[model samples]
Target chain A: MASPARGNHVWVGSETGILKGINLQKKQATNYKFGDAVLSRHEAVTTMCWGDPYESEIYVGCLDGSVKLFSTEKGKFTESRDCREGEGPFCGLAVLDGSLITCVQSGLLKVWRDTSSENVEIQVGPGVCRMCQNPEQLHRVATGGKENCLKVWDLHQPQEPIFRAKNVRNDWLDLRVPIWDRDMQFLPGSEKIVTCTGYHQVRLYDPSSPQRRPVLEATFGEYPLTALSLTPDANAVVVGSSRGDVAVIDLRQGRLVKCLKGFAGSVRAIQCHPALPLVASCGLDRFLRVHNLHQKRLEHKVYLKSRLNCLLLTSREKWENEDSPAELQSDVKEEEDDEIWNSMEVVATKRKAETQPCCESGNKEPRKDKPSRKKKIRKAES
Target chain B: MAEKLGKGRTSQKAQHNAEKAEAVASPGEGQGAPVQPDQVLFPPSFSVSEIKNKQRRHFMFLRWKQQQRKEKLAIKKKRKKEREALGDKAPPKPVPKTIENQRVYDETTVDPNDEEVALDEATDEFAPYFNRQTVPKILITTSDRPRGKTVRFCEQLSKCIPNSHVYYRRGLALKRIIPQCMSRDFTDLIVINEDRKIPNGLVLSHLPDGPTAHFRMSSVRLRKEIKRKGKAPTEHQPEVILNNFTTRLGHSIGRMFASLFPHDPQFVGRQVATFHNQRDYIFFRFHRYIFKNEKKVAIQELGPRFTLKLRSLQKGTFDSKFGEYEWIHKRHEMDTSRRKFHL
Candidate 1:
């Protein structure tokens, strides 16, 4: 599928061995299945990102355990089956300087990039997903998974992370933190990450200084905050919640800008315009709302048909100022005709019934197994 | 259910004190509230033996949580700028300690083992229920406590409606003194029990008005009377004997308070065991402290129509124990939550 960001082009890698360029401007885009149609297994798209500058060479992660390279130039994709199956079920894919970092569910992360001699590329791996190149020291990169401590590998000595940051033994830190780290932030233009827990407090940490404690923690919300996004400038963090309340915590002030409330469900995803202060959040409410982080009001709401399991927002503009309340009120009315919101009642009812288990067979097992496991792991490990 | 429940209309409100009920109670006792005919009225009465023993631990835990959160916030504010400048160079500062008093209103456990343990300890000296021999001279109405456990729920008691005066003074030994204040209005001498305002169906404890203590007291008093008279005191020993005395007094004073007397009852609840065969009613879940030692104390709820369900106590327990008296059961039903210490 086309990348959700501002770029007009996308690297579409389909399960049918199809790697193609899909133009958003055109109604009829071209398609080319990289392999014979008969060999396609219709695998799930594991991960995809705008991995290139020109927006070409779409990196497609597939469940079948391989990354496919789709070129917009050829209008077709090629598979790097060189990586064996089960070696990765890469859930995350990010591109830094033409080098690819793939985060697999099995806790293994690999970096693939060209070395000298151009085509003679090095595929370094068997490491965790804590991979990030030191902007100050390009040769020095780090890798860690949620399960393993981070290890920094210099192109010269690619062994372990430079030094272990004595993080609270939380599973998320134990592994490379998630794409949306709810607890804290990683400082801008640096390798520092922040985390928060218990009453929605934020804590900042710089792994470079592992033994030292965090720098700042801004507390907000009356309950547990479930999601967080950085303002494009990285000065303030837009925190979201287990309840659909959102707030902007200005680090300079060490206080919450506002506690925004509207949605009835816990927030699941948060994204802000790269330049514009507009923030888009979607959650169990199934409604994607765009708000001016400053005005902190519902600007636009796009009703999705699902509970909005996940979303990606890509904007090129930077946020400049706060929004006015009057503008927000009018924008909210425009969403009244939103058909996605029109189906919410029915969707909620359907969801409720499916969630409750009917006594099945003669043997009625305790319904708590899955629910308990999730609760236990979250409370114990996280 | 809403229509069936009548509102509270008390004209005479009193505070509790270190005295027996018969001494403070008029023939028609209460907060001088006229008992509504349709409502089952009663006092907020229960066995203090339950909570004084089994549930203080849980109450203490909640107090600790409140204290921790307060300290954490204060220290954080003081160290904010300094720490941010250090930027991970220095360790995070610890939470400060500024918060003071916290209160608790919930009590879950009231089993025999714990009460027995308490009975063996200090309660035997202070509470009369354990021995079922001593007539308790003091009735302590409390909401909850925190100021280092040095005071009763006096803070909460002050908030008790019918806006009353409250008191608090540690004893000579620096022991906790449940504050009781004197007043001239409806809340006069009223020390409100703050526990009533709690959010949940509060598992509250009070001085048990059970027949066990009454039975033992009555039996012992009557036994001595028969021995002194050299004849068997009649079947209705205590009731008959006390009635002659209180009846004359109940009516003459009834005339004096004719203008102040209650016409209706304000209470709710049917008979049910809450803590293992312990009978409790919702009506009298709140009580009154009418004119005692110049300091009146009472227990009352904050809202109307609090929903609650019984946990372990059964319906038949009271029946089997006091099977001989139909009036006791009827009165128990009416008495548990009824406000009609009816004239």
Candidate 2:
């Protein structure tokens, strides 16, 4: 599992009920859709998790309260099961030692045993936005959302949460701070769990500490801090806001290091490469962008037409050469050239013909006459 | 006649003094006493008829004329004294400070020949507090491998947006196109990447400044699905309706989405952009109106209707691996309920 050459496929789930596998080596993407006729048309893939360490089996949770199992190697859905009705969409999904773990927006966390009909269920709290499992301690998961403060649940205990975060004291205005943890992540080797809130706050809470409140808190953009990801080095956290502002915050100092700009809409999901100094992000803008964290340059960008919901980054190295055939590359380039020329030719020819004489004459007469003609048309219409 | 006149003058003087004494004693109620003397002196008395003989009448007329002249002289002297007391100053101008007494300056009083007052240049006093003005110009283009469906989707999508322009991504590097787009003042760029002739990937880059986001589109159901559900209305032309976005953020988001489509549709264009929400998922549908004549019309599928689910959003360009990059995940959580979100 620790090997670096395991796979380089980036799996992305979309609102259109399709799962896409992007082969980094080949620069190719393949879409996988379930063949089941009973699937609801409006059902969107909400949450996904790897079922096995080999990264072959994937469990997908849909908005329609159904969980489906897919084999990455086979590229087909193998099993599907309906969750409790009216649970809303799955807010989080994970796999712990062959048991399927799922959490819904209404805060019903369930663990389904592969062989037994019985399942373990716990109510984390209502309005739960996200749940994240600690890689080191798979049984421990953190859940938080609106009115649902941070809680660390140990699956083996199956009772009360091990750690429940208390709300911070009222702000300087003496107003109670709202609890809306949009995203959370566990530090690599520490008990500290960092959570980003809709209030644009990033807070680190150590369950081991005596205090229930966050040990450190920092704010980012003014808009809701929709999503956050831990840097590979674990020294910084990347946070995105509803207004499309993304920034890196130094965890030790609780200060923003830099901000990343270029988003028109709200940011939805972001991920940092586990081993590489790379970060891949997707959003309502529907473009998958891979940025080099060290150089702060966009390495690769692919436009996926539909709004993406979630993305999974693989550990396999990027395909720099050899996998993408020369023929396909050339073909892609030709098609792109043709597209540009088709649109540009029309505009360029027309503009050049019209502006060439105007430039040669170096007079404002032609420009003035153009408006006069338009004025005459308006007069005629009137 | 002289004795009668003397008696009348003595009574008038006594009445005036009585009114003055009343005014001094009861200031509040004395306002009514000054009016009573005028009412009492106006009527003529018949007791004066005895002085009507011819010679006596002539003497009485002379005496009356002389008394009237003396009264006029006294009034003139009194007025002169009052003027001297006031130091010959001009009459006090009325100050309209109270609501009832306030004056409204009418536009008609303005001097037409007065030079036009120059308006102060719009200050940036509120600029820091207010969101910057962004022109909603969107550039719709396709990915390098342009499929027919994706190209057509770009065309139809561009039409839906009011100030959008569509061009195929002819192998033109985004770097090159971005400068061009910036020069053209395009605020947004939407890239449609196709897989297997299906609109698969969507890249929306905010120009000049960007937190470019990529989305994966799936479960595309065209207008045929709406028609099958019997939800398509009987209209000759396609109409885009964005519904159920109630909050200010929702409204602005809806408006931002609506601004992506052209405000005025071309005569031949029939597509509509409908963004309706149920729960939290906003469903985007594009439909085309097919009409044989004026009477019978049918709805046809133009562009692929799909739902947009946010996957990831990065802060700047996709260059996170090099220097430093920050991003956020689970952006969809912010869209769940409008009440809690400030955006």
Candidate 3:
């Protein structure tokens, strides 16, 4: 079970309180539950995140206000903890230096430490739709929701937000535009955060910039956008609407890049591979679909049999490898060897033209020329 | 008796084949291949259409049609005679091919013994109805200012559904109406939307919480429009029949339709309402049956029949803009293969 769990490329959290591990190569899905307890909607998984950089430990937050720790190494739930401070389902979950950080829909964000007395808490705001931690800066996290604008907080000081975003200007009718950031992601290599709104708009917020309002904003379909994931390059963002419309929108010009097809329902969660041009999305349709971002082709689709809310994708380059870095190094060695062979061919051509022709003309005789000459060179090299 | 049945079947098959051939011949003629049929019938590719005189051409075409029919009848007669002579040793009749039989294999077809799917269905929104914890109280209405057949259709629909009430829309939004209906102890809401006085859309929202389903309604035949429909239905509850709901999506739709009616049907009413699914289109029929002796049963069609093709299934009640959809039909992407069906 542990070995097969390690082979899984995607881990999906479903509404039926089942954790599904899908191995794309084998086209198999394995369901993992916590205990002998019957599956219930109260324990429905709402958010999931890696507990460490190694991606071996997963922290799954449930609607019932408890967080379960799943170890991919053992392919089982190793520990279950209660973080019932929040009023609603968890909006986001992250781990920082062994400490678990959880934010709920009712805006209760807490940091769970080894000791109960040491845990820190912060009130982000009411109706927190989503909270996401910055991958580069583990201490930084952002929160946003309905009628609540974007706010970035530093975990070091939970007193107040470091950067608070202001809502966009009113519309042409001089009416206030509603603010609802359904899902958000932090752009790697930068402080810019991209968010998809319930108003069907995708807004990019740059905390480094002076303007608190969105640096750029773009709208896609007519329905509310539920989920968004940044592409590996981070030049464009993929957003899925409540009506199951998934599209990639360019950040630079805010232009629509392309649309992914074959989605039957509203997409709840979307995750793009950290390095590969592949994005996996799952939703109310109960199907986990992985699409090629470059070609916009649906590559793999697995029927999970329950509504999916969140998903975590393995970041390893080679899925079949137990230790991917070692295999990657071996791959690099093959490329280096090919380079050396190419350079040797160039040297052989230069030597043949510069020396072989001159020697043949001077002798005016071909006495075992090709074989003896190549053998002599080989002998000299050895 | 067997020989007569065999003869009738053969005649039907021959007539069907002739009709198909005629259809093919008409298309060939439209493409300027007037001699196509003549080429098949004779070695010399001479067509009656090539005749200079219009009267002669018409006369020759009539003669050709008669000849084709006579040849078809003779062939059918020969096959029938051969089958009759064989008697009990006759070959089994060939089964006809249809898109339903040739459907693409659906991976989500629910197996009865599948524990996960059984648990899922047991905990779904309609679980209360299946568990008999809540009684079905349906509220049927129409789009604001419904006219003509749309209004009458809702009235007839309400008659078959026990504890159902038909009301006017009054132009109120569905989002606002849902809360009031919940407070009023209504378990389900049915909204019939019409375009140009013709019912074209049906929205069924399981109340309080949902899994609202939207369907494209077509081919409406009200009592007045029907040729030989039965009288007005009685107040007694009708038995509900759901057919061909095999896939997971289809199962959910079937369960939704089932929850709209009462659990224990009044058998004394002798009326049955059926939602038969064929190639993804759901055909609704309400009928009254009479048990003719112990061996035979005859059914008479009650009024108001229509067809429904699923458009979308939303998660929560009537919030089309914000509610998450469970399944939505994408015409271009999903309809690529005629054999592929969602429900």
Candidate 4:
């Protein structure tokens, strides 16, 4: 586990196009720019996940429309093979049962079970915004997207999705599975799923409950919820809002536990360690904060220079090596040069930077304007 | 007489040898002139044919004596060379302590914040074996000489180990319900356990690392050096016995505690209630635990991030088990318990 110390190891991906790993142990960071090559090769790392159960593996989803698999054991860009095959930028990724599932912007879903097939691709669309699987039965799959659809595929039969739920989402096109409904599995099992949205509310539904609508709908008074996580015990729901704060809702009592303060930007994602009751939240502010649920203390906070789009923490001793934050030996130095180009352009395009990039450009900027204005008015009063 | 003579024979020879050694040494001082080549010369005594033989024999004897002299000189020179080398490289002679560097020992002068935090964190981890700084020991009379002596000893010892508790045989009847309590060690405190169990919660970590826990009162936390399993030398009798005893104790404790928690407890520790010098065990439960090792991470928030690998051994004499990292820590906790053994 990354020790939640002030210097805890963290992976920071810059808009300039480089993913750097931070090593809190050595008080150093090793970073390599996603070269015009690795960036153009596998550009725009929108999501980052630690792969290979032992942690020597790293799966990065690039907006350049490629899911690059890097091996820390081999200590270099293992290979920047285009898993999406120039389909489009990869938005999110999840590693299930030793197989890697990636959601791309072009509405294509691909699975790389192992390092083989540098050019293999699988297409499952709604522009696969997010992906998840039923842990109880690995065959049950859930893929959500821009079309307000949640397609559950049982790989046991790959040609057809076991069941598809339509009109599940109505807002943003990008969707990611931030929580698992382990409670929703059947007869002595559960299937309840709780999902957060760009739509200012969190909804819970049980596919097995045979209900078209959500069983529970949790809404926030202010900005839309960008990220949220349910406590392992399912007693509370922690949501990160567009207005830069993390709120803990006690579901049993149906009241606010406590809201953490001090982030300048919106919260992106929230996750809880299975064995730790603590809540970990990351977002536009690029700070990873861990809160001790019982003690109600934000135990530690690690600041990053760039926005954190997604994060997955599994027990891996070799995780920080994923980017080798401070490794001078990496041949990927060209990545930093590419990042320099992106950040400099972003610097020139502050107006666009203000507009959420994850929401995509042009149309979403106009849409994000109203909420950000409301946030400013509310911040002034609060 | 022969037997007696046999016993004293080496000594008698030694005594005579001493005399001979003395004789050889007395005139060997610098004042005595060293034998030179010219000091002793031989005269020729022989007839023509007979003379050749006699002269040859005499010459041989002279040559032999000269060689003996050379050998003696060489031996003497070698001893002189050895003494000179020893003078240059021999270890410095021990000098009696001058008492200049020795100073009065005082532990209270450290930064209180860091000390408190470190002690709290460590004692929290090794909670069960911790001896706290508060809690005054009220000695009871029936508490035979041993009990009172132990209490007095602990009063001084507990200052060193911050998480430990000693009841000290207070004559008060063992009551099941008692809510009233105060920190009697001249410190401000309050009651924790509403039940009759010990006031201190067994720190799943309140354990000392082996015998190192015994000296914990000095507030120095030490980890026991675990010898690599396969490489440990087994030829020594003491090590073999100690290894077997600790191995069984560890396996038994791990099994017993694993059953108690069924689920990984918030805390970890082994509890020993000593009465009549015998120990009955109890496992400490925790409020929270954070563990990170190789392979699996069983976080409370995520459950088990990876497959939980736990290896356990049932209670059977002479049983030793090497489990996964998860069980290894628990077994470590078990082995940490102070076992009553013949010192």
Instruction: Point to the candidate with the largest DockQ.
Output: 3
Please report, in order, the local distance difference test score of every candidate based on alpha carbons.
0.40, 0.66, 0.87, 0.43
Ranking, lDDT, top scorer first:
3, 2, 4, 1
> What TM value does the first chain of each candidate achieve?
0.54, 0.79, 0.84, 0.65
Better of 3 and 4 by DockQ: 3
Candidate 4 is graded, for docking, as incorrect
Write down the TM-score for model 4: 0.38
* Pick by DockQ: 2 or 3, better one: 3
Clashes of 3: 0
- DockQ, every prediction: 0.01, 0.01, 0.65, 0.00
Give a tens-digit lDDT track for model 2, residues A1-382: 1111223367787766667777665566666777845333256688888876656678888888888887764567888887753367888998888887889998899888865566788999899999889989999999998999999999989799999999999989999988989999999989999999988899999999899999999998667887888999999998877666778899998998877655545667889988788887776555577777777777766655455678888654433321333323332343446667566787647744754454445445557789999999999999
Is model 1 an incorrect, acceptable, medium or high docking prediction?
Answer: incorrect
CA displacement after TM-score superposition, residue A169 of candidate 3 (Å): 1.2
RMSD after Cα superposition, model 1: 30.9
TM-score of each: 0.34, 0.47, 0.86, 0.38
Q: Rank the candidates by DockQ, best first.
A: 3, 2, 1, 4
lDDT of 2 at B217: 70
State which candidate has the highest TM-score: 3
* lDDT digits (tens) for residues B221-323 of candidate 3: 8888887788889988899999999999999999999999998888999999999999999999999999999999999998689999999999989987788
Residue pairs clashing in model 3 are: none
Query: Candidate 4: how large is its RMSD?
Result: 27.6
**Could you tell me the lDDT of residue A215 within candidate 2?**
94
DockQ, candidate 3, comes to 0.65
